[model samples]
Target: MATFCQFAFFIAFGSLVSVHADMKLDCQQDFVSLVWTETRPQVDTSQYRLGNCFPTSVTATQAIFKVELNACKFRKLVTGDLLQYSNNLTYVSSELELLPFSLPVTCVYQRPKDWYPMIYNPVFDTYGQGELLFHIGIMNNDFTGPAESSSFPLGSLIPIMASVQQASHQPLQLFIEECVAATTPQLSPNGDKYTIITNKGCLVDSKVSRSRFIPRQKSSEILGFLQAFRFSTGEQVYVHCTLVAWDPVGLDKTKKACNYVQGHGWELVDNPSYNSLCDCCESSCNARKIRSTPLGNEMVHEVVLGPIMISEFSDSLF
Candidate 1:
């Protein structure tokens, strides 16, 4: 069944599972990472042998997907050999009924006729708030020739497989990876709020935003990041200064109309700091911990603090 979402849009999770809540599923942004994997080198693919193949126009992006094993089943397939090709033919049949999300693919032949493996990176778009769950799987269906007359050495299992012609005889495994980047305020299970820090992303930020595509709030020192900032008694208020327009030179955003902010107020300072860390919605922002990867370190000059609530009684204390 299709899930009716906001704006009358619908989403279908072919596998009845929730998107993982631990992975960071950013909004309107794409990241590099393979969140799931399942592979088996040994399998009897005959069970799934419907002995049929489809017009190869299928792809990972398509709404409905089925695995085509003709390309991978044969270790060495001679060209134009239909008998040998059909002998090696493997496809989805009753073996796939148990899959979710049409068996998500990480690798597949780029073309129906081509044998090269193409890297699969699917881009998911949704306005749904909260953790996103994803379900994906892979299967092996190599149904070719007779079991008893096989040339390869497998004396231990020759008698048992004498009757089972074309049946998949391998167990299936499924893996799930979730992202909480869409959760409310992007909260983690351990209570950490994740925020996107512009072109530099979470690790970095630019003095100016390069592309308005991955949009985020622009802040100013005039908005009070250097010193003590106060907030209302008990409300989690998300705030950003209202920008009347941008400067002609850098397209630098400027908040000229303090009166127009509508009680959100405004600030002006001689020393301006483009510090996103110091720009939370409460009394105090969380301290960012940095770690280095083999490629690079966390590029940052300072841990900017913001209007983040330090405690439940932050307003009462200050």
Candidate 2:
């Protein structure tokens, strides 16, 4: 469902002239839509825009604009646990002597509380010869959901959580060395694949899409979001990821969650101060010898998730 917002247009310059423009803002979980209506003074629909983005559809009296939440030059901010993105809409008369009117628009997403592996299905959990218990599952937009097969809208964000149950083992850190999506439940070497994560923890998909890794909440857990996509039209998708367990405090260039920023290159998500460790993301990350300790040997597991349907409409699996 869309949240409708109504804002009155105030004159920024020139005479008031009884000009009234009714603006409707549709703020959704993954995108924003806007409709600008001019009922009074006649105006050119082409002059209206949202942050340099023109209307996707326009008419004599109304101009409609639609944009994804992550695009359109929106300003992003992280305040505590809340994520905020904002932009402006403007209308400028085509007449030679007229001033432009602008309106501010914003969208905020807050993380849900106490969401974890307990709510997930035990079927998706994989045990590593009783030494480690690993679980991989899908999540709702707010990060709460059952760890079962789900459906997501194409081009939307898919929340995924990977965790390790340490039972009586030593403290550990979890890293996703690679993630690949295919049409079948089992990933084959020669099958068509879409790489979402590679180069150890580098999120290569983020370079072209909105896919990213969320901040770490626990040493044994790693959460991230993959932008919904498809390998074949309307075919169910499955994700296979290689999970590795390492020493919590022994992070190096080869073991890190790095995201590629347009201008800043690769950045370390877990700890920015350790950004130097992500410098190797642009190229190949060298392999390190396994340590002789329980946590150092790095328990590795390959986990599969999905049968997720990517559809035209939006829906959560929770």
Candidate 3:
């Protein structure tokens, strides 16, 4: 009886070992089902065939994303086994939308040897009491791209001037003088006029008050001035003192005025006549004449004004 019982015990132990081995082999050869889950509570099940020697379980590298293998059934799944999957991707934050505005005025000054482009910044200053002078400058040689015309506020020319003064490195004196001495006027084909007037005429007075006169103050004059220049979007034109004198308040005009003028067919100057100042008339000055190039397409419209001086003595005084 004892021998028979021992034999039965051995047989039972062998059977148990065989079953364990079979289960391990099956697990290694079986296809795994992967389940993907998200915070939204939706889950997707996919099947993936595992390597014959794959381990029973494994941990995922990312905490937010997890991979699971389902090995409950041996049937070939239509969607295949759910393989390693992740659903814990981070969502990106939304950005605020901004409105588009017209491009800013681009100013280019070209000498015979080199050229420099700058963005025009309109500035204002209060000498005392209610006295104000609107000063605009090309603060830097930043020629990244075309500037937004709306970047400077039309009604805030004085404020823009003040802002420029505040941001200047030097202590801006309330009594500043204009630089360019001569400007010549030109008429646009579409009837929009503009002139480049030098500060030579303006510097005659000791304390010339500078203010941006709106069209309402002088409508016909302003209209006449604007009608003189031809503005092109892609062509580069020289912004001489002539144009500045014609429309010193160009910086103060409304968007409607600019758009209207532009729509009227103001185009870029291709072969701009530089004889307005007669500076290029001299044989030595021929080297300094403005030339048109393929890059002229980058030229932009800008209004620049300066202090007044006598035209005859502009070369010396300015």
Which candidate comes out best when scored by lDDT?
2
What tens digits encode model 1's per-residue C-alpha lDDT throughout 54-162? 3223222211113333333322111121111111122343445422122222221112243222221112110111222211111111212222331211111111000
Candidates' C-alpha lDDT: 0.19, 0.70, 0.19
Candidate ordering by TM-score (highest first): 2, 3, 1
Please report how far candidate 1 places residue 200 from its true position, in Å.
Answer: 3.8
Ranking 1 against 2 by lDDT, winner: 2
State which candidate, 1 or 3, has the greater TM-score: 3
Using all chains and alpha carbons, the TM-scores for the candidates as numbered come to: 0.14, 0.56, 0.15
lDDT of 2 by residue, 120-194 (tens): 332221212236888998876645566444877777788899999976553457999999889999877899999
Q: What range of 10 consecutive residues in model 1 has the weakest lDDT sum? A: 155-164
lDDT (0-100) at residue 150 of candidate 3?
19
Q: Write the per-residue lDDT of candidate 3 for residues 1-318, one digit (tens) a residue.
A: 011100000011112112311111101111222221222111111111122122233223111211132332111101011111111111121322311111111111112222112321212111111212233432211222222331221111211121112221111112111222223333245543232222321221112222221221111112111111122322222233211211111211111111111222221111112113222211121222222322131211233432111111112211
